[model samples]
Target: MYTFVLPESSRLQEVSAEVSLEELQSQPLQEMIDQMFAIARGERGDTEKRVMVGLAAPQVGIQKRIIFVDTGVDIDRKNLGHLEVFINPILLKKSSAVVLGREGCFSVDPCLCGIVPRSEIVVVQALDRNGKSHTREFSGMTARIFQHEIDHLEGIRFPDRVGPDGVLHWVKEDEYPEYRKNWQQWKVLCSWSDWCAMKSGKSSV
Candidate 1:
């Protein structure tokens, strides 16, 4: 029964604390996940408009190196969509190739969305929920999601990645497919003032 920590909010800006194996199997970890899911799923009326693919412990006011990824599961308690939990995650390797994708976050500045560049592929190593370690590779949108949550663990936000003029508004597909065709130009003219008024208390989808 807790809410997400907003931008410039209660959460401190620092790398999250590493979770020892003992603490991973205890109640504190379970409680932390509970709060994260509550916010991720909008169960506490604090959810974002966009579908949340993953969430980190720091966003839930817990500065621990823990994160959950949605892999299409049910009844997982804290993060229903959170099919997997990673503890003390470490990036083993990342593809040199990168791509620009429209990215958004639950902890970004109000009323703003941006097209941030992201790695095309990433291989990470971490401890699973059962405290077992595993190495996995992720690509496409899934890779993007993992990177975003990992950034939280390192005290990084989506806005911090925006280019000099990369801020954009959430353009709907049916309404503005043209925006996609004219990517760079659209971002330049995507005026922050226009979206500024649209800022809600939390980040956009």
Candidate 2:
């Protein structure tokens, strides 16, 4: 369904300073969003880096102020079972709670680590990949990823969410399986046993 995707290492387009609807109205926003969904639907590369859950227009070099996210829901493939949808995305409102979480970028390695601070929840308004407008309520990782993508539209990256002294790390994706296996062996993490068994790291559902 798409032909162009921003390379993992490409310099993402910076959101034009003070971009507004006037800018989005003039961009090929719909086409880019369609291409993003096609990439997420696994029509392209085989790596987890490319089949990720979300994207930003800036990442694809269209700096007209837009983003696309597919929270990967409804995947039959276990741990990746996140809701799949796209957001043209404008941050409507946000709660001011600092929720810190691990983040990785397709632009870099799948196994990098950075702490990103985000609202516990958000209310957003945007059009879908179809150009149909809608308002969405998001919380948890879903909210975090969406908010992160929104920042990309504004020329921000996950590391920007880190504090001045925040640290970052990089690990191999192949190692996640062993790490998760050991993590589940002793800790009674919420559904750790089931989730661990279901998630062999094959599908980023």
Candidate 3:
């Protein structure tokens, strides 16, 4: 199983390098891609299984401009689980319109989530796994996923995109009766200091 490089790790903070067509088609690169897919599918890992929609090379300690995203398209035109692989991807354009949505990361604590602002639409050019170059436009959730993964290549994380007024929430595993009754009222109930303490205790455990 592959271990994800978490936040604060130097590997996760370095910009990734572009790859050549020859390198993309190499055996080792193919195996790395396969392993990434397995981790995304929850087919590998000793921890609790959690399926991921997208993954980047840097998240797994490979400093290469590569990412695979499950576009949620159908297999037989009516199903799901279609994945699009991007190699040496470059963001060409972003729409003026933007949206805010909650996001989580595999390299970050699973309980941590934060609202992030992202372009509503984006155009990206990239080489596919087969080394074919193509440009595509993505919008909505798919666009958000692409932007998030691309940021990883630039050594950026979702938390870094959160605006000054934005807040990061650490959700508790146990159910809270008060929170369940009125979630909106409890949005800021958990303090950042409390989360820090919880995280410190978890690491010791």
Model 3 spans > 4 angstroms off: 43-50, 73-80, 173-205
Error of 3 at 30 (Å): 1.6
Per-candidate RMSD, Å = 6.4, 9.6, 5.3
lDDT (Cα, tens digit) per residue for candidate 3, span 54-121: 88989988899999877763211133356778999888999999997666677666656667789999
Ranking by lDDT: 3, 1, 2
Candidates in order, TM-scores: namely: 0.73, 0.65, 0.79
Please report the TM-score between candidate 1 and the true structure: 0.73
Instruction: Give, for candidate 1, the lowest lDDT window spanning 10 residues.
Output: 73-82
User: Candidate 2's residue-wise lDDT over 1-205, tens digit each?
Assistant: 4334333323443553333444335556545555666665562244333246666655555554555565543221234643344445677889888686666566433555455678988888876444567887978777888888888766666755664555444446665444333422322122223222222333332
Model 2 reaches what TM-score against the true structure? 0.65
Candidate 1 residue 145 Cα shift, in angstroms, is 0.7
lDDT of each: 0.67, 0.55, 0.72
